[model samples]
Target: MSQFGKSSAKRSKPSYLYAIIGVSLILFLFGIVGWLFLNLKKSGEMFRENIQVHAYIQRSATKKQIDSLQKYIEAIPYVKNLEYITKEKATAKWNAENDTTWKKFLDNSPLPESMDFYVKSDYMNKDSIASLQSELEANFGGRVMSEFQYPTETVGYVSSYTKYIAAGILLFAIILSIIVIISIDNTIRLAMYSNRFLIKTMQMVGATRSFIARPLNVRAVINGLIASGIAILAVFCFILLVEKFVPWLKLLRDGRNMAIIITGIIIAGVTISYASTHRSVLKYLKMKLDDLY
Candidate 1:
């Protein structure tokens, strides 16, 4: 074949530059979604841990009885942290937030003296809190709490929506994974299209399958790394922007889990790119000479 024919064949092939850019964009989206999932889960956990049970202390309880009640609650194994809320303190906090002065209208502050405490992370649920409330009310009775209550509606809300959120995320991720695989495969194949003639030429000249595939595999690996790097850098920048704008989101980050997610992204990029390129090369090597067109 003339040199012009070879050059023309190469030019007919799709641009690897565009292929890389396409793959990188898709991978970047995956990284963002994965990171968001991690943060959402962490945020959910934080919300759970922040959930507190408020046990109202009896107005007529003596100082000795209050001390005993505090000691009793502290002894509870699943308690993460406990706080004492005086009626005066509660009134002040309420006034600060709601612009209401309880002191002037009421002879005694209507707010009850209370024990406010958080349950352990694993126990932050409607059932466990209910059990704890029942136990506290039964154990302390008139000595500590006149009434035991918590944000049951909030716990119920968390329970009601969490599974749905998880399912939606899972479905989105599944669809995203399918998209990544198909798009990357097509991108790599289009890229390999430009090299089909070269592959056939090498095979006709008696190059072994391994020898034909080796350089293409290496190139694929390199391209994959470059694409993964670009995607990761983009996602990292996005995360920084999120943390900057909503600084509290940083509290949900887990270093170890983030590292695992990043590692998975790189591995996925390399695996899919190299496999697709190799498959396309093998395919060209086995095709009839006339199919080179």
Candidate 2:
């Protein structure tokens, strides 16, 4: 019986290797998709934050009044990257961008001093900005904030398509997840096929199902860990290679999202391997001796 079991194990070893490689490839694909989604989300947020809104301060307002208004706007929850653009700073910015000083063309600079801030991505939509504009203009009886302005058309375009892109990626991820599960299940079942006779022989000899399954199940878990580890390493190398060429992509590296994807891949691997292996073992155990042929 020990010799038979040893021979069966040898026959199954090659199949187990192939199964791990196949599952690792599939998991690597899943991790790539997850990384792309996270990058898209981060890029979109940075772009939205770049579209800043300027709250024009009244020229006649006292410094105390401007400071009070700046403090008030800073307290708003949706605000990010707040800056107070003094007339001198604003003039200098325009000059640097246009490559000419305003003083050469006019005695007094025409650029307006304003409070500029970016809205958080979640509140960057047209309606949300409009609501926020209303709230800011209404503050201090509408006298402090002369006008609040952002690119309405740009906001409309960005916010509208963001939803569709997110929906499309999420749908793809869900479908790919189903495919991964099915593929891993099939691969594990195929690997288990080589051990069917050993399992049945053990069963016929009065070995309990659990006792016969214990070693195989343990082997399946170890194989799962190995597969996931290889997949994660492959993914990390791929990311490094890509980021080496496109250095800006490094800015979007989100550790939390990557961790979640890694955890998910590991869980999927272990769960599917164990379930499929156990299912296959039970299936062979229930078959008639003649069916072993």
Candidate 3:
């Protein structure tokens, strides 16, 4: 009886150990996914804001010429919006921006009317913006337009480098997810193997494979749910901590996007756990005890 009690206790320990390990793995996986999502979201937003194309109209450009140019630029597919600043308005804006240097520039001459072209969010990049600038210069030419101004040095490099970084992070996350799933499945399989003798006994008595697999399946799903719930809670807490310390880290400032990301995380967690557990259980069911060694 004491020996049976000792064996029962031993059996219980493995389940608890497996549950702990599973939970830890889930948390790690969730962290990686959340980090990648946040980085991509923030980088994308910054990219959109930094992309701008400025068309400086010639000082002698007539009102009709300015209006016609604005209309033509607005019709472009990649153009999100355009703002027309008259010479007087641009001068006032510049004066207001630089109060100290206002007098120095005010004596020289009037500023030219300028059209600020904001490209569509996704279309903001070196290649697209450069193409749009070239097309504008070709169509309008230097007669009506004095010059085009865009900070290619800083914005171009930052936007391109960020895109590459985001792509690399996404690829890394995918590879990491595959590795994590396989590792978890193997761990679960080893845990199940410890009970192979009992499984064999049940099978010998004419228990169907489904019946034998039911309890393990149920436990796996429950474990997955618990692990996922904990991981999400941890992520939320971490976000809160970041907000407290670094208030600028507002990736999910929009309530709708925040909800969507949270939903995605939960779904990913559950799906990974379900697939890994199902595969591990199925593998064990097909194995013979002699091969188990």
Candidate 4:
């Protein structure tokens, strides 16, 4: 009876190991998704800010008028970057993009000197672009020969597509979060089961509830930290691999974002592990001995 009543714990419990492995894999996956999302957002902004709106200059415009127009556009709050493209430069660019020279198809370069500029990400909208065009025309008078021209249809499609992708990613994130919680909870409870009889034995020996809970909680914290560290290592390795394969992703890596995701993983691991263990221990402590079996 004494042998039966005494808690016989294995010197090494594989339950905790299995739990940690499972949690680590899940955490690593979450980390990768978060990293990708951050980069996608940054890349999207880069693409938007690079969509240049070309304001063609009048062929007869004076150098003073051109310089003044360039200076005025540069001063606009919404403009991110501005460049004055001479007729020669415009023809060269058009040739490079289309594989033919403008002068070959027409008498002289019909292309006018242009103020080519990109707007800030926040201003990359139909209304904003239109307002900018109107303002430039109004301010520069005839020196601004035509409306600022950009690919409105392409911009609208890309905007709509990314919004849908964002929605899908957000939905997946929420669902994955819930799964991680449940998975951690179940894992902790299974691990605590090995100590259930020990908890009741302590209760039988006049140990207070806090006394029974404290050591397990401490162990949970240690386990959580170790698991989180392992996950971080795996995630870092995965990032290195991705950087090797798709080198451009390295350019988008932000220190602040990486730190936040890693920190969040650590916090979530510790909190979930400790809370789940404490709850399981409390639950077993309250159960009748017959019910524990």
Off by over 4 Å in 2: 99-105
User: Which regions in candidate 1 have their CA more than 4 angstroms from the true location?
Assistant: 1-14, 59-81, 98-110, 120-122, 138-143, 241-257
- Local accuracy of candidate 1 as per-residue lDDT tens digits, 36-86: 888888888788889878888888998888888888889988887898888
Give me the displacement of residue 52 in model 4, in angstroms: 2.0
Clashes of each: 0, 0, 0, 0
State TM-scores per candidate.
0.80, 0.95, 0.78, 0.86
> Each candidate: RMSD to true structure?
3.7, 1.6, 4.0, 2.9
- Candidates, ranked, TM-score: 2, 4, 1, 3
Choose the strongest candidate by lDDT: 2
Compose the digit string of candidate 4's lDDT tens values, residues 1-293.
Answer: 35645424552267778778877877787788878877787788788888888888887888998888888888898886788899789888888888574456787877778888888876786767878778877887575555568989967866677779779878987997888889888888888888788888889999999998998899899889988998899989999998999998888888888898899789878999999999998999899999999
Give lDDT per model, in order: 0.84, 0.89, 0.69, 0.82
lDDT of 2 by residue, 163-274 (tens): 8998998898899889988999999988998889999989989999999889999999999999999999999999999999999999888888889889988998898888
Pick the TM-score winner.
2
Quote model 3's TM-score. Answer: 0.78
Candidate 3: segments with Cα more than 4 A from true spot:
1-21, 99-108, 159-163, 190-194, 251-264, 282-293
Residue-wise C-alpha lDDT for candidate 3, range 177-239, written one tens digit per residue: 677666655665666656655665566677788887787667667766666677677777777
Question: Which stretches in model 4 have alpha-carbon errors above 4 Å?
Answer: 1-12, 98-108
